[model samples]
Target: MQNVSSQQHFILNGFAELGDLRPVLFVPFLLMFIVALLANSLLVYVVVSQRSLHQPMSILIAGMACVDLCLPVFFVPNMLLSFLFDWKGISLIGCLVQMHFIHFFGAFQSTFLVWMALDRYFAICTPLHYQELMALQRFLKFIVPLVVRNMLLISLFVSLAGKLSFCRNVMNHCFCEHMALVELACGSTAINNLVGLLTVFLIPVFDFLFIAASYILIISTMLRSSSTSVKALHTCITHAMVITVSLAVALIALLSYRIKNELPAAVRVFFSTMYLLFPSCFNPIIYGVRTTEIRQHMLTTLTHWKRLADPEALDQDGLSVLRSGKSSAKALHTCFTHIIVMVISLTFVLTAFLSYRMNSLPNAGRLFVSIMYMFLPSCINPIIYGVRTTEIRQSILKVLFTYW
Candidate 1:
C-alpha cells in the first residue's frame, strides 16, 4: 500500500506541476496568432496575384510574406495542441524540428527585410544604377543564396541545440525557443547559448549596418535632388517606417535574449512580440501608407465587395452603391464597419465554441491563440492593403470581367 501510494503521489504531482500556469496562457496568444495569419496572407496575395507589384521591392515583400506565412503554421498548431490537450510540452525530437523551422524562417525574415531596405535604398538613392543593379535575374540570384544561407545558419543552431541534453522538462515559454530551452538544460550549455547568440545577433548586426549605410546613401542622394522628388521622399518615409519597426523588434529580441538572465518575464514577453506579432501587424500598414498603388487597390476592392454583398443598396448619387466612387469619408466608414463586423463575427463564433467546451477552455484557448497568432496576418492583411490598393483592385477587376 505504501509503495503504490507513493507512485500515485508522484504522478499526481507531475500533473499538478504542468497545470499551474499553462491553462491561462491561451486566449491572448490565439487572438494575436489569428491576426498575424490573416495579415500576412493578404500581403502574399497582393504581391503575387497583382502584376503591378512585381517590382524587386515587392518581390522581396513577397519573400517576407512567405516567411511570415510559414511561421504561424509551424508555431500555432503545435502550440495549440500542447496547451489544449494537457500536453503542455514537446518531446526532444519534436522540439528539434520546431526549433529548426522557426529559426530558419525567423532568419529568413530578417534577411529579407534587410534585402528590401537595400532594394529601396538603391532605387531611391542610386536611380541611375538601380535598373542595371537589381535586374530580375540578379534579384532572383540575390534571394536564392540569402534564403539558403539563412536556412543553413538556422540548421547549424538546431543541430547544436539538439546535442544538448535536458534534465528538466520546464519550458518557460509556449514554444521550442532556442535560448530559453537551452538555458534549462542540465548539461553544459555555454557553447549552445553562445552559438545561439551568434546565430541571432551577428547576422542582424550585419543586416542593420547594411540597411543603415544604404539609408544614409539614400538620404544623401535624395537631398541633392530637386523639390519635384517629394514623391520619392514619401516612398522612403513608408519604407523607413516598416524598416524601423522590424529592425527595432529584431534588435530588442536579440538584446533581450543576450541578457535573458537579467531580464524579467514581462521583458521576455515583449521580445516574443518582436518575433511573432509586430511583423504581421505593422508590415501591411506600412505598405498601405506608403504604396499608393496598393492603398488605392485595397480601397477599391473593399468598396466593390461591400456593394456586391448588398447589391440592392443605392447611394444618394442614384448609383449602384457598389460601382459608385465613394468619397474618402464613406470609404473610411465602410472600412471601419467591415472591421467591426469581422471582429464581432469571430468573437461570437469563438465564444459559442468555447462555452461548449468549458472544461477544456484554457488549453483550447492557448492552442487557439497560437494558431490564431500565426493565422492573424493571413486574413487581416487582405483587408488592410489588398482591398484598399487600387492597382490590385483593377487587376482583379480585369480578371473578373475577362473571365466572367
Candidate 2:
C-alpha cells in the first residue's frame, strides 16, 4: 500500500468489483447524467429567460436548478471515466476539491429546500406579507449568509480531512466522499469525525427540522381556511414531494453509511450515489410538471417554437390542437400514464431502500435495484413530462417534424 502522504493521487476504486459489468453500467449512468444535466439546465433557462418568472418561488427554483446543475458535474464525469476506461486515479488535491464541492452542493441543496419550504409557508400562511418578505433582493440577502455558512463549514471539514496523514491512497467507493476519505487517514480522526458529524448530521437535522416546522405551520394555516384550503394545498404538493424525496434519500444514505459493515460495498455505494443524484434530477420534474406558472411558461415557449415551424398547425388564438382542449378519454390516458410512471419510479426507489434492510436478498438483485433506482428517475422524468404534458408533447413533435 502506498502512503497517501507521499502519493500524489488517490485511486478511486469505483465499481472495480463489477469488472466486465462496468461497461454495461456506463451507458445508463451516462444517460442519467446527461438527462439530469439537460433537464436542470433547461429549467434554469426557462425560469431566467421569462421575465414573468421573476417571482420569489421561481427565483428559488432557478437557484436550486443551478445547484442541481453543478452537483452532478463534480462526480458523474469521473464515475464515467472509471466505468468506461477504468481510469480511477484522482489527484490528492483534486480529491479534496471534489469532496469540497460535493459537500458544498449537498448542503446548498438542503438550504434551498429549507428556503423553499419557508417560501411556501409565507405564501400560504401569510399571503400579504409574502410579497414584502420574499422579495428577490431580500431573498438573495438571506441566501447569501447560508451560502457563506455552508462554504465555511465545508471548507473546514475538507481542511481537516486534507491535513490528515493517509495510510493508503485508494478510496473504496466512487468519488471522494468525506467519510470515505477520512476513513483512509492513518492519524486520529476524532476532530475530523466531529466536524464531519456537525456538517453532515447536525446541519441537515437543523435544516430538516426547519423545513418540517415550516410545513406544519403551512398545513395549520391551510386547515384554518376552508375557502382557499384546497388551492393552497395544491400549491404545496410539489414542494412537499421534493422535500420528501430529498430527505428520504438522504436518510437512507445516512443509514447506509452508518451500517456500512452490514451491507455489501456496492449497495452502500449505490445508496450514496442515489442520494447525490436523485434530488437534482427529480426536483426539476416535480416543479415543471406540478407548478402552474413554470409549466405555462414552458408551454408558451414550446408554442412559440411550433409557431415558427408551422403557422397552420395553431388555431386562431395561436393554441396548438394539443393545447386547445383535451378530450375526456385523452385526459384519462394522460392521467394513467402519469400514474404508471409514478408507480414504476416509486417501486425502484422503494426496492433500493429495502435492499439494504434485507440481508437475504442476493447481491446481484440488490445491485440491479440500485442501478434502476439511480438510472430510471432521471431518464423517465423528462420522457413523462415531454410526452404526457400535451403542450410540450405537441411542441416537441412540431419541432422534430420541422427539422426532419
The model with the greatest TM-score is 2
State the local distance difference test value for candidate 2: 0.73
- Give candidate 1's error at residue 403 in angstroms: 56
Q: What value does the lDDT take at residue 286 in candidate 2?
A: 66
Q: All candidates' TM-scores?
A: 0.69, 0.78
Tens-digit per-residue lDDT, 1-404, candidate 1: 22222110000011132355555546756766776787667767776777887888777776777777778777666555655666655577777787787777776666876777778776777678998879977667767776776777788888987666555566666567777667656646778777777766566666667667777777666556643234444455555545655666576665666673444443354466446655655455555424556555555665666577785664654344334444553454446436644653564455445534444334444455456545755765564454445566446445644565
Q: Compared to the true structure, candidate 1 yields what TM-score? A: 0.69
Estimate the overall C-alpha local distance difference test score of candidate 1. Answer: 0.60
lDDT of every predicted structure (CA atoms): 0.60, 0.73
Question: How would you encode candidate 2's per-residue C-alpha lDDT over 2-28 as one tens digit per residue?
Answer: 343455679888555566666766886
Model 2 stretches with alpha carbons more than 4 Å out: 1-5, 258-260, 306-404
